[model samples]
Target: MEEKCLNIESKVVHGHSMFDPLTGAITTPIYQSATFRHPGLYETTGYDYSRLQNPTREELEKTIASLENGKHGFAFSSGMAAITTLIKLFNPGEHIILSDDLYGGTYRICEEIYKRYGLEFEYVDTSSIDNLKAAIKSNTKGAFIETPTNPMMKVTDIREASKICKESGVLLIIDNTFLTPYFQRPLELGADVVVHSATKYLGGHNDTLCGLAVVNNDELAEEIKLIHKSEGAVVSPFDCYLIIRGIKTLAVRLERHEENAKLVAEFLKNHESVDKIYYTGDTDNPYYDVMKKQSSGFGAMISFTVKKVETVEKVLKSVKLITFAESLGGVESLITYPVVQTHGAIPEEIRNAIGVTDKLLRLSVGIENVNDIISDLNQALI
Candidate 1:
């Protein structure tokens, strides 16, 4: 198939060159070295310090950029490192719009670390274009959006929001961690930048900590490169290799993840104990149509609420197959209480407004057998 016509599943396998040019190695080798020597005096081999670039890291970056349809890609030590680099791109006095239902760590860093530097953030429901438009201040430089948002599963129309951002001279930054490029390509939908906590789905097995940032334009790529280099937050060669290995199976894994999630969502929706369920796969969900229009799949993350806060504890303590823990998008199922886990850093008032209440529980439905997963949930709810 032509490169441009290749499907995402195909892209996942062949996005970057699959073999090493030097030795015909089928897998990209980890170029594990702190620095590379110049070919000769005043001549360069296109690599200097590992912090600036590495052969293994470059391959992963190029592959991610190809997968996202972006011009350039960068790798970071962690998701927060990528986010920190993004925040540094703006001046202290400028403002950025953020999703109210953002990840707790993102909120914590912005509130506790960046806010002290004179950077301002406005939390708004970006799912409603009108609310996003209203939140844009004169000094607003950009907007950070999370669709199928963390814990809440709120979906925002990236194309529509990007058009508004362009009109108002604001960059559109998307957290594409939940739905990897295999499912959604935010850059193709008009986002200027797409960031990911590759430690999640992109690292599929949950064995590595890596972050990625892809930009659609050269100027933004240059800007991020400076921050990535100067801040010394680049991903190590070995972690880059692991993330690359994870990317190879992403298509198949997500296919199973979504399939299992659909069955689980159906089970939860019918159960008497599940008072309210959040999953984009539900046709009646507020963002269902929008999600269908913008992406290929509903993703594996699901959040549901029980009738009482006490039931939440009962389910958490009772799960046998599903592990109650932090972090997600791995082969093993994880059930998290966002009120005390992922979204704990956000204040209570803000949390309640965004529906991260004590009665709510989030599930990272893994690529497990549907019946076994359902059985676990069935037993836990009792």
Candidate 2:
């Protein structure tokens, strides 16, 4: 079913039923066998082995593809694995353009490993069309953007950037981990490929580590599928099952997350110890208009700065309800200091330039009562 044609809640509920009509089972079963039995030497039902392909994983892939409005979806061991596999499609010495503010792991992958293999990248302010235009080079093969970018929360104009890249014959890739398909559909906005760290929102509970890549182009999908098989980074059947189960509650969980986030953001904005709150729901936010145009919801992520590093430490240590944690997008609220937690890998100069400061804190609002979350922050700030 087309993403736009189906209700998101319905898609989440019935999109990936593993049991075919012949058996009529309620839940998808984990096909634990390593290899499927072939009828004859040359006969097959499109699956040969778990490593090459698994029935459980395929069902999950189909569900994700339907959700993201893409022709195909591939599951990987982790979000980085999905990214690495997609990048392998490009030849050595090919150039890539990326947003200046990105997940620290993405930055490290591009600078450390990709660079070592002759891949070149230029980091630019992709939130502006002019910056993207100026950054494009003859050798540029792909443009990667992270909207409401990590740590800084800078929203990129996906449609505008996709138009520019399409005209230049450059592949447009988006990291949709922050917003997820529940709030935003990058493919509908003209992105050629979308990637997510299923470890986050897609799996919701922070229990499983997985990644997914969805592509609209059939030819590109085949290439990625090939790389997935060759590289052997596919997610296991059990992880696939866990992710599929997690997705069933995505719609409801995201709604609660958004609601809680709005309340927490407002609380931080008025807090005496807070200096700034970076959230897309705030009309005064720099990327407010663009975010509104592209996403149905503003999402649950919030970044704010306290008075100083000392105060930051005090608040983190004092919080009772909100867990001081590294990863986000779980069922429980989490707090992180980006300068040392999420964006710590980036150099100090680069981190500061991208607005990842020592005083900055990120909150992943969970599906908990807003008062409990706020009360924890209140006591912590005091």
Candidate 3:
């Protein structure tokens, strides 16, 4: 054979290319110039401006598309920017349904910003296919979901949801942030589009901010591309370089993250202070089979409720090894209080109904030694 196919591990390590052809550099160089020069009249270099496209950013986009097994990829300045731009694909009167338990930022934008545009949003428990089917109407144009939803770890069946969406002429969009492509590929499982806060795992180090949308449909890809270029929320060439470097080690980092997370889940399960824990990897977890069927591995995020609501503040203030912070998917562990920090934008009533209460805490188990992480939690619980 002239060529051999590469596995996901190799595709990541050797993204798009092994070296830059122009300069023979190992890493893609940042094309920092905002505008490019032309050779002559009616003749133009492929890239005329950075706003439209940059060589570095283009490579990153292609890399992400390849990983997600999609036809096109668009990168934005941040995760929220990507979602906001994606909304432009629908008309003002188009209705969309979303998972009830999702990132507070997404909820805030749809309600506070996009509501006035005449787009109607229905919040439902998408973990159940019946709830999703019940919410669809004649005008329903799309369904957005976060599989193994934020804070709750509830898994949604992408294949089943895709079938329903296709039957109803609704486009299926999946926020694949938590599991990343290493663990789950939604498009491969039948999703029409996959979005990610690349800042989390694709950037890997929490050092860069990026949002990406990968689309399998040609028409959807073209529309998203138009909006991306016209709105100019594109990621910078330097940040693109950072994300490209981060993705190179994604396979190895995720392996360690999942290993530590499983151990942490076991520790919390037997702990006296914890009342209940949410882990996708748990054998008795209701959606464990769905995760097993759709994904290769359970992600590293874990959420649990404390016996006493007062313990929330104690743990938030007590952890020394694990930082009390907002963002996740970094090398260092982070403990988040969703009620106030991440999910505060969500209404209290909705928050309560979804189980993001004062007693609840979300943990992003990093690739640290399992013993150190558990010891920190053990002492913090005391």
Candidate 4:
């Protein structure tokens, strides 16, 4: 297929290259030196400083941009770094409405760090487009949403939300971390910007810590570039390499992850202890149709609330094969108690409003054998 016509699987696998210009290796080598030696004065190599840019990082950025169907991509040291840089794009007195139930770290920085700086944030159930439309005001400049939101797993209609934001002249930013480019490209769906906690799905393993951002327009791209350069949280060359290697198998990993998640979701649905199960692949999911419309696959992240809060720790400690961990979208089938581990930063009242109560458990279903995963969960729940 022509490069432009290539599907996501091919695009991610065969990300552009003659490999590295220095050695022409099949893999992009890490340009480890912090400073690049110039040929002379203003005449120079493509890179000047590692902080400004690096060849390995640039290659990763290009791949991410291409994957997201956007014009520019930036890699950050961590997800929070990318987000903090993004918040700088807004001035004080400007308001950005976000999904009520989102990653707690996002809530933390916005509340503790940026709120003090004058940025206004309003949390609402963005799954309801009416709620989003109602939240917009004269000062509202942006709407940030996480489809299939954290712990609760509520999905929003990205295209519809984009339309609403456009009518109001507001930017629509989607945190595409849970789904990643393999499954969904928000920029293609009319989002102004897309960001990811690449540590989760993009890295594909429990190893690397990284984040990514992509912009549809040059104006936003330029502003983000300036903030990224000024704030200096660019992903390191080695982490860039790790993420690249991980992307090479993203399509394959996600396929298996989804496969196992289907079985797992079904298992949970009939379980006595599972009070509520959240997985887009499940046909009964409230947003199942919306998820099917926008993305190719529903992904492996599943959050369920057990019948009793006391069962939370029992399940957490009982699982043998699955790990009790915080992060998601790795190759290991890890489980997390969102009330404490992930969404602890949000106040109890707010967390309870969104159903991220003490009873909820988030599962990052891995590409393990379906029977093994099910057997493990069965034992845990027992």
Give all candidate RMSDs, comma-separated. Answer: 1.0, 1.4, 1.2, 1.0
* Position 315, candidate 2: lDDT: 90
Q: Put down candidate 3 lDDT per residue, 1-382, tens digits, no spaces.
A: 1112667888788777667878999888988989999999878888899999999998888888888888798899999999998777788899999999999999999999999999999999999999999999999999999998998998999999999999999989999999999999999988988999999988999899999999988888889988899999999999999999999999999999999999999999999999999999999789999999999999899999999998998998899999999989998899999999999999999999999998999999999899999999999998
Clashing pairs for model 4 are 148-155
TM-score of each: 0.98, 0.97, 0.98, 0.98
Residue 36, candidate 2: C-alpha displacement in angstroms: 1.5
What candidate 2 gets wrong by more than 4 Å, as runs, is 1-4, 17-19
Per-residue lDDT tens digits for candidate 1, residues 257-311, read 9999999999999999989999999988999999999999999999999987889
Model 4 has an lDDT value of: 0.91
lDDT of 1: 0.93
Candidate 2 residues 51-136, lDDT tens each? Answer: 89998899889899988888899999999999999788888889999899989998888888889989998999898899998888
Error of 4 at 41 (Å): 1.5
The lDDT values for all models are: 0.93, 0.89, 0.92, 0.91
Worst window of 10 by summed lDDT in candidate 2 = 14-23
Better of 2 and 3 by lDDT: 3
What is the C-alpha local distance difference test score of candidate 3?
0.92
lDDT of 2: 0.89
Among all windows of ten consecutive residues in candidate 1, which has the lowest summed lDDT?
1-10
